[model samples]
Target: MNEIWIEKYRPRSLKDVVGQKDIVDRLQSYVTAKNLPHLMFAGPAGTGKTTSAIALARELYADSWKGNFNELNASDERGIDVVRGKIKEFARTAPIGGADFKIIFLDEADALTSDAQAALRRTMERYSRTCRFILSCNFSSRIIEPIQSRCAVFRFRPLRPEDIKKNLGQIAAAEMLSIEDDALDALVHVSQGDMRKAVNSLQVAASLGEKITVELVYHTTGMARPEEVKQLLEVALSGEFIAARNRLDDIMISYGLSGEDILKQIHRTVFELDIPDYEKVRLVDRTGEIEFRIVEGSNERIQLESLLAYLALVGENRADSAD
Candidate 1:
């Protein structure tokens, strides 16, 4: 019933993590040896990097995990002073409760500035005996090479749909909510393999009603229904320019969707169309260009209408060739 289902249902131990089996098995090996090298976890957001770090610390130190583990977000204090002050003070200190070494988790380590990273490398070297570092980032290339060389890098991949569904299903049962099959599919579509986003979407949908339906999920998430989006494309492809543009206006206003959002949905729908492969390729290419224009501050309405006009033209051209 808690509002934040993601954290509420966060796995306490690494074994409970939904995906990343190989990473979990390797981390368990370190736990068995009661030793760990400096580790770098490179992955996209919401892929259990923080959970793994917390779970590792707990498994390693048991009751004293809190005392022996220190977690800091580098994005909040990404400067040389933070590296020298808080990081150094923690690294140089001895572990409490007779533990061999303390663990310092630096989340978003890629956000640290070059000067701060240079300072951190020396600190890491100086405190090797008393401290081990776990650096988490979205991109490993942003981290300096020296730091990369010092740690064993583990890359986390996006969760598969089945894994995300399994996790969400578990949450649904625990919360005593009923979810339709189509609704689950919608969650998967919107989340794009992000468990946190899926769970959060479910939580928001649940608050709106007792039964989670496909409509509820899309409404809560501010995304147009897949069927509606596909229909829009179908109408445009039929060369009904005025009708399709009217439908586009309704979809955008009703869903409160931005131009980019609609474009992304259209892009996905393009591949699903029964049209020829060549046509799909051309549509995707044009979609990318429109996306770029929108990003550069062009009027969303004008660009979207232009796309509809193009689709109508494509339809017209196809009719001519078939004659």
Candidate 2:
């Protein structure tokens, strides 16, 4: 069976991990000292929180990494029971290879309930001698201050475009895939600094054919082409409300995109529009309102059409002022 490229190409060592240079350097220091405090990795998704935890364990434990490291997703069982049961059991165990302490990596730790986090904080305090905890969460604020104070916090930043491109380029060369330059750009744009998304999109595109094009990247990823999104906005900005609505319908149906997806694309395309900054700001503000309405269960089609109408109004006012 062909392995998932994300897993196949995951950075095995701190040196192999891309981006988060500061975090990686700090982790290396802990490994050099063979000592670790309870750690909290706070960051956005796919920014190497989990990967960094796993890599730290491997470096610290070497051949015994698997035996000493326990991985759990707090989101799966976010109640106090897990903290009292499985976690307590594992945390009290002695390291198998004479290591100072075992590591427990809790992913999505912010998902834990108040009671569970309270229990977890106590557990970390009690297990400091026998085990160390690495907690990963998208939002550190959701974690109780007590737990936050107990751990050395590392904040990870989103990957840069060049970093993502370099990693993808290496993966492509290794996989012997031929990808067009525009296809690579499409992947980067679609990924929005998420390495996992970028790699998975590339893998999906590669499966469809040997040579990946812009169309393949966008089609496989279920994203409308940027140019198409820009065209929709341009049509609306020219006061062609009906024409813009028709184009909007085409883009949504063609990509099977959700209302939020189309709205997000439109929002991104707005700043790039040739209109003045004030118009762009108004369009962006209106897009946010439409997005909020859609998220609140408003009818997507009506909400989207209303946005196009507003765009037409903005366009008309701009023309009148020019005259």
Candidate 3:
């Protein structure tokens, strides 16, 4: 059995891809023409950006795709010199297999420095006849305007719940297990639309050799159960300071979640609470501040604990005011 479902089931052709149908259709047009222009794929991680780029190359070059396609992660290289060096080396030889231009798929292209992007723009122009560039990043805004204008840009959204559900269902059946209803719900909720994460969590649960259940999925994925998160809100909002603090600790320690991670989930959880919209906005504002502090190197535990305390007070004051 293949250990890594991600690689085992990665889409080989554009049609095999899960969602993002409009982007797939546009890419297929290029495949039919056998002519790909410089392209940019912008989206969150695990959304099939790199997969689409590779699949396009495979469809275009057939058996010789391996020789003609180059893959690079801009984050791995320390500087633009490395990018320039690699591009020079790859372009030294004409594309193999009678293809018009070789392809260099640069993953995390936004990580490249501004100076690097500038150099890259020139590089793309210099090698337009010999190579095409496919840049993928989470934020297209980070990429320079010149680079953005040069290529066909495709924006990828998070996979829909149905898309994730159908794919995971197929994978679960293939593994020959009876998936509990809650397992799929927990998996989708925890994954937050990252298909890679959803598939990976499913694989981890299957490795335990037991029926996949909600608790097991949460344990395997190191995620706090939605109910637990809800309860945390309940405890905090009800002004149970010690209990709320302890619950926060349990979630953080048990799940190995960072402060920012917990805070972001709390923000999501706040919206689900049966609180007034005004109270929800207040809690979200506090969460936003703490998240920033955690990211900016403020002490994680201290900051989050403070936020919980504030929520407790807010919940109390709001409850009393309603009376």
Best by TM-score: 2
Question: Could you arrange the candidates by lDDT from highest to lowest?
Answer: 1, 2, 3
Q: How close is candidate 2 to the true structure, as a TM-score?
A: 0.98
| TM-score for candidate 3 | 0.93
- Structural similarity to truth (TM-score) of each candidate: 0.96, 0.98, 0.93
Would you give me the overall lDDT of model 1? Answer: 0.94
Which segments of model 2 are wrong by more than 4 Å? none
Residue pairs whose backbone atoms clash in candidate 3: none
lDDT of 2 at 151: 91
1-323: candidate 2 lDDT, tens digit per residue: 17899999998999888999999999999999999899999988989998999899999999999999999999898999999999999999899988999999999999999999999999999989999999999999999999999999999988999999899999999988898889889999999988999999999999988888999999899999999999998898899999999999899998999999888898888888888888788888899999999999999999999999998998898899999
> For residues 279-318, could you state the per-residue lDDT of candidate 1 as single tens digits?
9999999999999999999999999999999999999999
Residue 196 of model 3, lDDT score: 96
Using lDDT as the measure, the top candidate is 1
